[model samples]
Target: MGLHQGPDPYDRQLCQGSLQRPGEDIHPPRPRGSGDRLRHPRRERGSVTLAVVRVRGIINVKNDIRDTLTMLGLGRVNHCVLIDETPQYMGMVRKVRDYVTYGPIDAETAALLLKERGRLEGRKPLDESIIKEMGEFKSFDDMGKAIAEGQLNWS
Candidate 1:
């Protein structure tokens, strides 16, 4: 009765381009907005506020792990740094803008790492020639203009 009932022709292709490529369709836009709803429905809602802390130095890194357990707050580790959400000394922690870890490195080892990094893709060495050429730019605005217009090659 319903036009020789079989699989609905509209379901297969009509819906495909309706939501995506709505411009190609001659039909007026769907009444209740584009038909597709909940594209990524599984994603969770709500914002999570977190305090990030960075641990530096071999000795301090070790100490922070032990101290973080006794400390209040959410604790997580990212790479070599320990981020403690709950800080014991909240006032002192709030003033911290940046944290850095410095490990001892011999000159030869440093030079080897630099050389290896330079050879890697997307890495460039700051050679004297490059530095001298960069010195020609008086300010960051001039450098940005050159880059935006395709005149400068950062790599």
Candidate 2:
């Protein structure tokens, strides 16, 4: 048996399709930015997120209640928005609780909702760049989670 058990990098370069081009060095370049780009940060298990879905019309709603709903991005009927359980948001929710329904949201459910309903004005799709420009986070799931935890206040 030889001292080296495995094939050398040069030997496998051809088989592995070497990415280096003419004049390029054999050493690969270091990755840019934080390595956490691919893998998201772990959250505590059983952490509950808050979600609100407008269940009634805004017609004839009291001025205070209507204003609260509008501020919450719930101007349209059946418009569902994810929020944290902070006292400020909770108070707003309380003001219009009669016209909406809310409950705890799990991480999986939040991801699904963000994929489907998350977006910017003018029907523009929400992506990593937009998320970064709007908030500190770069990942869509992170944005949703931060908002749910009241760490990133959209309102």
Which number leads on TM-score?
Answer: 2
- Clash list (residue pairs), candidate 1: 72-86, 73-86
Tens-digit lDDT string for candidate 2 (1-155)? 67877866665666778554457668756778844455434432223357889999977878989889989989898888876665677789888989999986665666567667666788777667776786577676776666556465443
CA lDDT of each prediction against the hidden true structure: 0.37, 0.71
Among residues 3 or more apart in sequence or in different chains, the pairs in candidate 2 whose N, CA or C atoms overlap within 3 Å are: none
Identify the candidate with maximal lDDT. 2
Q: Could you give candidate 1's per-residue lDDT for residues 1-155 as a string of tens digits?
A: 67778877656776677443335656664557533363334222211112233443234445554454324222433322122222333333443322433222333433343333323245555343543475866544444344333344332
Error of 1 at 122 (Å): 6.1
State residue 29's C-alpha deviation in candidate 2, in Å: 66
Those runs of model 2 whose alpha carbons end farther than 4 Å from true positions after fitting are 1-48, 127-155
